[model samples]
Target: LENTEFNLLSMMYDVANILAFKAEEKGLELSCFIDPYIDPFVIGDPLRIRQVLINLTNNSLKFTEKGEVSIRGTLKEDLGNRFSLWFSVRDTGIGIPEEKLDKIFESFSQADTSTTRRFGGTGLRLSISRTLVEMMGGSLSVSSVEGKWSEFKFFIYLEKQASDSVSRKDIDIDLSTKNILIVDDNKTNRDILRQQLLKWKCKVVEAESGKAALAKMREAVDSMSPFNLAIVDLQMPAMDGLDFGRLVKSDDDLKSTILVLLSSVTNKGEIDTSKNIGSSRYLSKPLKQSDLYNCLMAMFYRESKSEKILETVSEPTGIIDGVKILLTEDNLINQKVAVKILEKSHHKVACANNGEEAVKMLEADHYDLVLMDCQMPVMDGYEATKLIRSKPEISAIPIIALTASALKGDREKCIEAGMDDYLTKPLKREELNMMLSKWANKKHKQ
Candidate 1:
């Protein structure tokens, strides 16, 4: 097995990110949590681990019509240099029958023939996953109730790489002095947030609901200690994040407290609503530590009054609004999805069916950035980049490569082809936002 030292948290984020668009398209919530206490840098076969997770999560999404699919990793046992990690993919989907469960992991076998016809799979994923997990020193297991939910889990021992461990000092923003409030109806969500905040040395207080959070905030205020930040969940029962944010913003005393609203991927449109309600930032779940760190960095660090971090974090389009982007791809479906994601962030997007069209479009108009797909019918992204670089006028614009290939060295190939960066399909909106924020030239935005 390809054993290497990798950031466990980053690997989990990549899995969630790659599947995020799919989960959103299916109208499902995808949540990922890795135990905060565990040192995230570990020695293991990350690729195989990621593959198993993706397979299980994809199956969960395929079968689940409603509710959420959660991927969680807990520190089962701390064994000094090695740790026993319990990983699980849980979904509120149709589960296997008790008798059929034993055969589900058999090659070419499924819960039933109807399941094969309905879900449309070769039914080899679980079998292959079991093989991979066992190769990695773990045995895959499942628990399910036929009509309700299913959970696939395994325990694997990984060597903790303390030399590569992430600490509070690694974060760019200073959170030690910050007092934060986490509001979520789910205790697990709150606990995860609390643990993360505590790890960053932030003082955290949790509330079960928006109303309870308000009470806690009031108590903190009355005691001459007020929370500077509040993280609220969007889908709470009675009072949601938008309503809570509105109430806080309108209050004379609590108006200064920064509000960051967490929403499911499907509720991304509600970002606009959160902004309208005066929330400082909106993050789509499942949240990654890097994304949360970036959000906090934006909140805490601002250059000027005009460039308020709140607006930078909350605006409909992106950090730089009204950017003009040219999308180059041959596939109609990929082109459409990319366009929609770009436009949703308030950027103006133009599509080129092939690389030749992309070159022609660039010649005709100015664009802030170019999203170039590697393979196309008429021409390819590599040739298009070379041609663009040969020109003096439009040569400086950033060209981010989009590829479906996951083979090793693909990124290096893209960079060698003169691409600024690369992303694998399908794309996630949060990732696109981060990329745009990185490559979008300020002068190019309207």
Candidate 2:
């Protein structure tokens, strides 16, 4: 029960989302997806797995200036209790030369010496990622073409968890006969979205670029079956989403078609501008089932709040949303779960593998709060809390105990050792939200 079946889907998407923002900065899109049938949970060091994804995703983004970087996760073998999962990261960027591909995984070596200058990396990230994958009894492999694309994948075995649940995706509007257009330069992105739409019985059409999308729409109009919705990437060659929207709105027949602008980055100004230019709504990537589903709902049926993406999901957003938090947890799975929840709400998280590491991080940087796991090898939370309390400057900072023991006096032990509050293991989002909201409000009052 203490850190077994970690969610690979959650880890992959989380890492992708974090890195997608970086890709977006350079006018590129980053996308991540799972097979949907793949077991959501797998046995592994969640943090290490996340680290592999982070390294690979960031590497792809770093090299890619245009087009997209994508991550895909699939189950190769479902062995009931254990499964073999294959994860891959692909990018439409400058790829490795045939000769250099063999050495990219070697320490201090990259595809080219000039790459080190053009793209900022130590060239050690891929080596470290490969090492981490191998440590989990997996092998990392790569295949790339020069000036085109690169894909890195690993096959890892993991035990399945008994107690796991996947979120349900419910569409409010009927997609049975709807005609949808998906426009993205990336084949992976376009294919994934097209497949999902097809499964829902929607008539799907795809275009690799904005010009092609416009031509498709014009053809559809001539055939008398105009697309009901268009999901256009914000960054595209020839014509961007904004320009496409302006052209679409200029035509009377096409103006009736709903437009949803998709971007890896959630820029308020861009979203507003898209709406002003005739886009029905804006959705941020990496796209999730919930995002796609809700986007469809808004575009077709929900007219009141169609323009704003989840404008009321949580108006009085948790104070932790944008706050800096230090997570002092030893268990990789637990750390992943907690960090995932915190990040979904937009909080910036820094992790400490153990109490000693947490102390070092705390001294080196500032965190608004601490989530301290009680059990650790190098330094336990109790002793770590005492040391942190001993420091005059940070003594006033809040420390919350995260413990697996629900036994009597556990709370008292945490309090006695200087933890300001207690949270049980497998923390619930509601409890965390309330705890953070309470502490954040208290801190604000102070």
Candidate 3:
């Protein structure tokens, strides 16, 4: 068995070799360039770093067919006390478009159906890689072209010391002394939030409505133990995120407490209003653990841990409130089927009969998620998604491939086009509902 503590270059080379073999199968050249002066002994979990490198290299090999795939590592000395190392995997395959570049690190994202069909993979490598990098005090990034090539780059800080000298004991991160109030009408949403907060060893309180939240605030003050932070949901029954934030900010006693607005709407105006109401931050629902942890760290650590903390949380806005969705498909029947599935959940849905329409719609409106079809009249889902992601305004919208094509690489292609998620053709209600529910609920919690 491999040791978990050491950062082994040999293992990294082995992974590169495996990917190189895969690349050669498609007549692609693969190579690696490692800086000789770089420190070989760095503090980190070797297994996790290896996992990140393997995933990135594998992705490069999977996408490149006719050209070379290169992996390189270089150390930067200008990082002050921190030793910053940059690692990149370059591929001469079809590069990613500029707009879709941001979503590449998001989970389940793929470029398009064509890429997915040609290469079979879940498109989760980058997201997983990003998570691993962050845990090791680093960041992962990418640069790409539409048809030329793509490059995945990451930077990590390595403490110049032996692993044994560093304390490996788990740190007790407690939020129990500080009160946390959760405002969400949905019981399921409240439960999930509570569970996650509890994992952080927080003392959690729940509010089912805006009125209840206010009452709880009053009760907490009266009881001589007030909340340190309030997590409020938008688009609720009585008071929405904006109104609730306004109320909390206006109150002298509660104004100082951090307010986090959670929503499923990508309405920019609403987000601005929340900012004006003294909300420290906004979180989109379908809340990821990393995002939540980062927000909390920012709040508590404030000045000292700002950069490290905020990196984990997204901008906290641009979430879809009424279930902002993009529907892509050429067949009218399939579009209707998809719409019916979403509408049943009372989610607002948008439709594109062809890839061109999908692109146009994406340009016109901000969607929380997109459902794309493989085949279409004017433009196909692959081309449309690729184009949509190439645009800055709509690039981050989660694009789910809705196609009849079930080939091996089709999923990978969808991810390669910067699509966030995927669903097979002859859509099933249960599957769609599960996805919508999971993501929508996450938005609600944020």
Candidate 4:
């Protein structure tokens, strides 16, 4: 879960651009364009906003075949203090019938049987998008021509920034002045890094392959504008990122350049393998802002940023075992109640409002165990746990899920997501204590 405030256009466009590679696989062109006049800075739940954009763009990609799928943003109203932002995803694939436009937005509905058979979706995207938009005080709308094209749009508002107050990452240095080169064969991964770095005002250049990246490096040296940093994906063809990193480090001409490795953790054990490569730092894939931010800080200065658990053993009984644990849940009432209960038992406890916060806390501090909520926003417990499992360093720390219900198959899903156990809601004091006792004493393996 990431909490950094970002420019509105950059945030939305990042989500839109990440799917470009997926569209490319289907032989379609995908792009995102933002209006220049928009204030661009806004503070909101970026993850939720991204979810809405990705869903819309993905839907457009599914039906698009011959032409392009594009995301466009423009200013709708200049309110002085704030502005209304409008975004649309237009596709030149199979268009929806005029009469069926409204029908498709209905719950569990698609355009028609033929549409479902060909495109393959539950038709729940618009329905879900409408709900999410309304929650953010926005409205979702659509327009299309039968068998020609489709355009889905939405409007949201953001307060204008009087000045630059987004984030400085607590460093006085201006990262905006730095030049960076991004290397990754996967278009989506490269775009993700570009969006993040560019938002910080850094100059960015892209290299689709490792060899191209090396060429760009040598060219920059010749031009007397060598990159300050190069973030390369750990997995690439013709030259693996490890070998590429070695080559860059060995080159006397590129002596001062910083190299950070990006790993996908496709092979769980490779997380350790990545560390063996010489570089400033290495991070797991689907790159995280906090991790990337700290990695940059380390290159300038080092420090920071976790996952699942195994079945833990119970400790000897006492008046209070004095076990320390981190509890991540979004419900304030539950937070208070859980803290009250744990404190009385002489257990040290801390809380995170959401999964994203939970991950950040785990990275910066130590906790004997984690009580994770399954459905919280930013990053769900399921995803958080999977990420933890990918990191060999923290994967063995036990995690128990806090789920609202124990519906059929819910346990399996939690376990698959890497949780060692789960606690049902309306949680009983006895159940909470028992689960903690099972996991609380065994510490994280160093």
Candidate 5:
């Protein structure tokens, strides 16, 4: 039941089922040993904790093909009035190299390119898990032996609760009238950023390319108003955050805007360059909500009394009006669900059940955007996209790949095949809208 105590066992069971399905598909075994006595209630976010467990279990399944993946959770200890809970997920998969074990927890850091080639992910799960665990006053750690297996363990301290009543409304932030700019080449990243910012009631603007971001700033200045902060991506075509920031700082009028550079690059030299441009903060890509929130809070608190009051941006629940979209999917259920979501956002949508249909439809009519399902009958997304790109007339049309696969090299493959962006399956409405809005804005500028 939704209102029942947030039991770790139930969450583990869910993870076990997911792993079991994955194992079954790959011909492996998945099991769990969860202690029934482990505190089923904690004054914390259960959904987030579940995400951590699922991520670990999913990782286990990804690496293991013939061996078993086992999960165990128990009461580590109770320290007087407070209690510590520990959970371990172990796998008889390819063990991580000892040298690379620590790096795996870093955002976008995988053991090797081959890992990405074989398994699809942004390599963001573990990093997100670490952040989530820490936010809940917990610690997550990992151990592995090369050519053997691996184990991931985490401990969280929780106060015993008498009732299963908790409300996230208490954590809601008030962000009204704050102007925030999100800059990322990836539409999904922009979407996630926009949705999270909007939740705080902030006014959100998006730029897909760094060149466009500079143009946006100029437009804002021309209108006699500028954004409060710019969340710029470090990697983009035409221009990057370092160069963009330098340009911003060089302009006397735009110098006042706070610059927050985002990147997946962990090289210290690159970070130093960003800092030299007078950026207020630097955030790594696959942004975390808590870290972003903290940075915003710190920025607001440090601002001068004469500065404008900041508003929190909230997630937009409905779709923007008048946008036309093409849905390229072979699966009827997927098409229905995706179209229903797009319709809720007020977008006029056209459907193509396969890549050939999508191509044929594109030839006859112009759709504002295309959501191409990667794997399809008749013509797969990659081939279809390449075909679209080869055409001189329709080459500029933005096409985003909707994929269920999260293996490494997937995003790169999509991009190489001519997709402008991508979203992993079980699509979130906010991410979809963000991608649409971002490309739509680009189309408007063109």
Candidate 6:
């Protein structure tokens, strides 16, 4: 058993982000809620826990056609160093019939024969999930309403590392009097944000659209009780986040309020535009409470310290031009496409057909970063990264994995192999540039 100390919230966030694309593709909202009472740090097999979570969540997404899927963790019992945590994966999906529920966890078995034919799964996910949960000292159970919804719940015990627990009162920033505004087109999204903000003791106002948000901001300012911050959604109907932020920042009255723009995609252009228009921060959607808290803390605590807040809360502004990049790929077409994109950004680009060639090139020359492809002939990116990391002369140069695989755990696999970052294939220019810019300032070995 790999019992190690890790942050439960961070692990859940990783699972949520890894599956975010699949959730988006299905047009289903994927959200996670971790009860604040749950100990943040616990001793257990994080990998195993993460595996069970991914499997269960994947199963829920597979069966769900519309609506939402939510993963939640709540504290069942807390005894200082030992705690019982309850985890549930709930979905508004096709539910298991009461009669067939018993067979759902069987090996190679689904709810029914028609499910097997239509879903095209080996039906092993639940079997594995249940086994994993039981192995971790938990009994997995399910509840369903046949045609309505399904929830899989389990309770597991974990040993919390003996440390001083930090509560909201212990935090450095006091949010008790802060008035925040949340703008999102979806009620569920708004509710999620509202709950989190309320938990932090901040007063919150919700707006269903950018226009409504603008009205609220103006009204509050005129009433002499302006919102301290406005969390705006990027993709809204009439007036999106950028337009709303432009109006807010342009006005002398509302300019002092912090603006945070949330987007589902990592579009570099949008990030740059948000920053240029005086937005204080940009965060990803299906927002994590921890991230939002950190952003707010940075914004409020270092209100006058623009440089410090930027380093803490903001994305790298724009493309870092003129850095030399090593592109490693066995596919000729991918190499050509990447080189063209890099050259367009005014970056010096070099190509390697495979990992071995890439290593040889790196040894012979200096590059700011290595864009390593995960799979190739002779050697793969993982082995190449290991080899590069072993050599002190080249170890400090950043290695970013470029792969077409969006499979579960692919990102963790890349990081475990010593890659600094990951980028899925069919690359977007904006995302590529943003990733490069993020690592461009890394202290490279001379």
Per-residue lDDT value at 260 in model 4? 81
What residue runs in model 3 are displaced by over 4 Å at the alpha carbon? 1-172, 303-446
lDDT of 1 by residue, 1-446 (tens): 65566667767876687677667666777888887667676777765677678768877888898878899999888888898899999998888899988887887787878887987653556776787788778889999999899999988889876653431123323479898999988766777788788877888999988899999999989998899899999988899888889899998888889999998766888888888988889997878876787777668764464234223222124367788999998898998888888878788999998889998999999887899999988899988876675454555467899999978667655654546678889988888888888557322321
Candidate 5 ranges with C-alpha deviation above 4 Å: 1-5, 80-82, 114-122, 163-446
Query: Each model's C-alpha lDDT?
Result: 0.78, 0.76, 0.67, 0.69, 0.71, 0.78
Predictions ranked by TM-score, top down? 6, 1, 2, 4, 5, 3
lDDT of 3 by residue, 1-446 (tens): 11233333333454454354345446554555445345444444544555567668767777777756777677866454347888888888888878878877877777676767877654555776787677677888898888998888888766544534331222236777778999987665576578668767898999999999999998898898899999888768768878888888889877777898876423435777888888887875444444576688788875664444333122222333478777777778887878887777677887777888777777777666677777777888777865654443454455677767787666556655555457887999888876666444333322
Superposed on all Cα atoms, the candidates' RMSDs to the truth, in angstroms, are 12.4, 12.4, 20.4, 13.2, 25.5, 10.2
**Candidate 3 clash total?**
42
- Steric overlap count per candidate: 1, 0, 42, 5, 26, 0
> lDDT tens digits, residues 1-446, model 2?
11344455555665665565467567776788887566564566665566567667777877887888888888788787888889899899998899987888887786776887878654456777787787778999999999999999998888775643332212333488799999887787887888667656789999998899999999999999999999998877788888999999999978889999887654656877987898888888787755786678766777765534333221223464577889999888998999999999788899999989998898888787899999999999999986775454455467889999898667656754656677998899989988888555434322
For model 5, residues 118-226, the per-residue Cα lDDT tens digits are 8654355677678767766789999998767999999977666553344111124666767888887766567657766776788899999878888888888899779
Model 5 accuracy (lDDT, Cα): 0.71
- Deviation in angstroms for 233 in model 2? 2.4
RMSD (CA, Å), candidate 5 to true, equals: 25.5
The stretch of ten residues in a row with the least summed lDDT in candidate 2 is 164-173
lDDT of the structure predicted as candidate 1: 0.78
Which candidate number maximizes TM-score? 6
After TM-score superposition, the amount by which residue 83's alpha carbon in candidate 6 deviates from its true location, in angstroms, is 1.4
